[model samples]
Target: MNDWLLAPTLQGRTLRLESLSEVHAARLLRHLDEETTRYLSRGAPADLSVESVAGYLRALNAVPNRVNWAVVTNDGDVAGRISYSEVRPADRWVEIGTMLTTPFRGTTVNPEAKLLLLERAFEVLGANRVHFKVDSRNERSLRAMAKLGAVREGTLRRYQVRPDGFARDSVMFSILAEEWPAVREGLRERVDAALR
Candidate 1:
């Protein structure tokens, strides 16, 4: 088994990324309710009851190679969830994703989380690649990836079906080892700007 597949907790300021737990059930419910599932590939419902959300979180936590983390704000609010999944140690790759609440959107939270994850994946975990797959129609995510210097590799047609029963194309983006130095610098600059 690839070591990168090991689900691990990564922490950051304005966020505490711990492995997904049953304790996050309520927070997860709050998050899924704040966003529409139409643009989310993970298919989280917009209105999940506490029990239902707990069940969902438990199920997801049971999955291997998936480290789900609750994104806690500086105010100690559970703002959203993010994860590094499908870790392929042999290929030195991982996928980072999240369903951030509107309050956290377009904020430094997303990029800072990604930066921390990348630092761990590449510097600590010896990863060579980090991939981000987004719904082609999600302009926000695409724009964010572009800002981070992730190159658009290509599109996967009809990659999956959304909750609305429509086919969704996936836009694949990645930052490889050779490109990490520059990308890292670029991301650092962006995060620093947000701090200023």
Candidate 2:
């Protein structure tokens, strides 16, 4: 998929994913707490200065193959960021990752956002698969992925080295195009229940 074309806003009932921009840096900074950054390979930024955040935003925009979005509430508050990366058009697959703000966690925000992103990946982008890789030590993430109907593929030992210089194993999970119908229905149900 063309990078420009793939950047369209994906909207849901309570949230929207808009193309990531420098303007979002400030709002994003407020949410990247120690808890949020603990599992991120890059870890937390040593400095949360405006300039640093802007630089990070610029770097995100420069990536050619991936599209990052600022996850914002319907009322326009930025809640976090998510992206489709490791995009392989020929293979018709992509990997999704990133962190959400604490307030949005365990809420409908994540399920609905994933619903929107997965729909765009399978329906709009014609992806055959969408995958996620979480640090193997992260039980919460592992459970969350399972709840979403993603099949646990296996673990990759020493798959990534964190900024702290520690090698981390990654737990892989995926949902194939053929499984999208069932996965989508389940996610919709979860979102509905969450809203209620």
lDDT of 2 by residue, 5-81 (tens): 37788889999999998999888887767777679755555677767877876776677777889999988888888
Tell me, by lDDT, which candidate is best: 2
lDDT for position 95 in model 1: 88
lDDT of each: 0.76, 0.84
Evaluated against the true structure, the overall lDDT of model 2 is 0.84
- Misplaced by over 4 Å in model 1 are 34-36, 162-164
Candidate 1 structure, TM-score to reference: 0.88
RMSD of 2: 1.6
Question: For model 1, what is the alpha-carbon lDDT of residue 152?
Answer: 95
Worst 10 residues of 2 by lDDT: 1-10
Clashing pairs in 2: none
